[model samples]
Target: MDKIQHQTRPVFPFTAIVGQEEMKLALILNVIDPKIGGVMIMGDRGTGKSTTIRAIADLLPKIEVVSEDLFNSHVSDYDLMSDFVKQQLQEGVSIPSEFIKVPMVDLPLGATEDRLCGTIDIEKALNEGIKTFEPGLLAKANRGILYVDEVNLLDDHLVDILLDSAASGWNTVEREGISVRHPSRFVLVGSGNPEEGELRPQLLDRFGMHAEIRTVKDPSLRVQIVEQRSKFDSDPYSCIEEFQDTQKQLKDAIIFAQSRLHDVTIDYDLKVKISQICSILNVDGLRGDIVINRAAKAFAAYNDKHEVMIEDIKQVIILCLRHRLRKDPLDTIDSGTKVSQVVNDILG
Candidate 1:
């Protein structure tokens, strides 16, 4: 019992995962520059989408929070905390803190609006005739990752609510005649197998970047994946131990990127390239332009480079602009392939 409480369940190491370079890069760039927004992954059913995300969540650095702050708000930012907590702090009340691993919350399918965004406490309202607010998944996900699997199958109304909170960074719940608002900032991570269904365009725009994944076609790569998974299933701890140094190196690299992200700058020429690509692709709004700019800068930072290059921009073009393209009524090519061709034509 003690060990379970003190430790985390074993996860497949991010370093041990096979292929899907595009998916892995999108996830890493989000961590480096969350302002690049979140990721929307569409892929085949057995391509390890959910597993890769959960593994990245486990590999992230720990965060420090005020001892009893329910929202897990950063200690320095009082605004992220509740009014009552802020009041206590204003009165010079000493609040201790503890370091805990960053959260990775899963939003279960079929969750009610109230469950996703809290509601009036029913017991309190009935017993004491006083309304009390109950925090839900949105509150718990503050400053963390909020993952939704099979997002295409999610109800439209629920999808709207999630996107609303994500865009506004606040969850507002009015129910049982009680109104409450709280910070709900989080990185939205969603995955779906396209065979299940396609995402709505409005909802699709909410994602910052999109990537597609498929099964490994090479027989040797397939065998390596199976062997690695079998070994981990048999000895999870030992597998983790073996990957420990590699994991630390990657984690440290992410930290380095984050620290110097602001120092990484995009040149005017690269900015023009971004706009030209978006124009040729006919992406709606300016989202494609903006996401590409951010993702490219992040990619350069991840490589320990202080300036964005044409190569950095090229590497992330498909991921940043894939979902933003308005589909052609007559074109027969897949979105990813079309994006690649257009990018090469514009940038080459």
Candidate 2:
């Protein structure tokens, strides 16, 4: 018990986060299908956005990575590794592995390029005058979640760097004659208060799903939130313990869903429906249609369904289409509302 206590710390339970159902579903769907790409969450301040994401960190299952690999490369991704790592593996070198929690890295708003990327090892520079590259947040976030709080406030250059890394699933550092490349596949999670600012188009369009979270407004729900939060604050350990079983169930569900997602078939009708919805919205690119199809399949997987359904597509319509809508100068309605209207006109 003593050793176990030292091994882990209590976190605010995912189940304990009250309301924001859509946001929670969005995160879960991403977990089920990271190929749906990443998620963008827009909400007001103090709305449990960060806490909910932090809660996700605790709920995730541990991953296996090649031992001594700084980038935490998965065994499956070993063949696609950098030339040096690959050569070592081909020489019958003993590659060991250990299990670790899926890394969850926070991208600070004021981070510099070097910090977001990385620099040379100090010991190598001092002892041998050799520049050995070190890993940064992108490296740490490989095969994990790269969470950016207040993403709208990030510098334009930093956002561009992040977008590029996300799109390519790799980060390469070439400055100072230290060339290093590593896989950086991560589920990008960006949350910002829209009132503060708007995300740039390039970065925003990359996200596959977007959710607008509102503060708990119902009196009963608010009371429940206050009560659960106060109880968790008073005794965090017990609170987390109470929800441990539920968290395990969700974690297992995610693992199972991932295994079965590939087999979950989509028919031609569903493809036509998704395309029709995207066509109605006049979304900029094929991303909208692709996201809708992927998010629907993910939604089905989450519900243990082996096939996509119209209801599943409807469930994720706003999340997949809200951020993809083209701006209309004369239109005053919210994008989510417009998406819903279009979905109704087409699907209903």
Candidate 3:
């Protein structure tokens, strides 16, 4: 059987993406610290959500992984290695490593549970007296990003599966008492239009951050965006060339931030203020406070700072806590506004 290969296409440079700063910041922070969990991007259609997400792959540095490993297992990080690779290591096998672009996988809305999580080859177990496992999107997304467009429209069960693997950093498949498990750690990025529907609050809270974007209302920015698209459509390579320097700068920043993330620290007063805001807002869990701290540290690292400040927390607090606020069917105030008000009251 012939293998199917993906054709590489020109992605719009992340630096060239106009507006939507919140979405961009959220994505970048997650790259620096995937422990912030992942970003849930809710925006209008044609707002370049997918374009911005895909651009992330090209904007970052490559990763070291075991060559030919389906799970993109890291060479030395036992936490990131797949079960198969771990077994190979335990048996004293030499594992070759290679540098590859960080993976970015798109999850189709119509995909099945088996297609998302994987399938166990029960037939092989019966006929060949051996069990084989088929890797799925989760496996491909290991050590990278998994993006789901129109995520609100995805099946609840499938959403649960993605969230579980994303939260646990592993995927397990069991069939006929045969089981296969692999490390599935990756940034889970979900984008959807709120007009279509909304994820249940419980499911929504699972996301680390929520970024809401809208159609660019500034006329000048709109014109600039349109002209940029026209130029890219006319000459993809030259367009990419135009932003190559900036892309490299952004990539360098991400790599450096990742290396220095652990060095960045947040103050106890800021932590107290963050929790106070969450408490005042009646947030359901500690996730809101924790995400804010991690995101602030990531933002500080990205900015070449050794410590997180009130400013860093201020920048991320809204994104981290907005969606976690208890839903008020009758309240007409924007969630971000509410978060900001609490920030001002507590942090000031």
Per-candidate TM equals 0.94, 0.93, 0.96
Q: List where candidate 1 sits over 4 angstroms from the true fold.
A: 1-6, 122-131
- Judged by TM-score, which candidate is best? 3
Query: Each candidate's lDDT (Cα)?
Result: 0.86, 0.84, 0.91
TM-score between candidate 3 and the true structure:
0.96
lDDT of 2 at 336: 92
- Which predicted model would earn the best lDDT? 3
Compose the digit string of candidate 2's lDDT tens values, residues 1-348.
343245366678897788899999999988887778888999988889988988887788888888878888776576335445676778977778889988889999889998888776766766798868877899888888999999999998888888788778889888655577878888899999988989977679999889999887899988999999999899777777778788889888888888889878789987997898888888888988888888888888878999998889899989988888777779989999998997888778
lDDT of 1 by residue, 1-348 (tens): 333234557889999998999999999999888777799999888889998999888888998888867778777786567665677788998878888777799999989988898878777877898867878999998878999999999998998998888877888888666677888878889999989988999899889999889889999999999999999999887888888889999999999999999999999987987898889888889988999999998999999999999899989988988888787789898888888898888788
Residue pairs in clash, model 3: none
Per-residue alpha-carbon lDDT of model 3 for 196-304, expressed as tens digits? 9999999999999999999999999999999999998987777888887899899999989999999998888888888888999999979888899999999999999
Q: Which ten residues in a row have the lowest lDDT in candidate 2?
A: 1-10
Off by over 4 Å in 3: 1-7
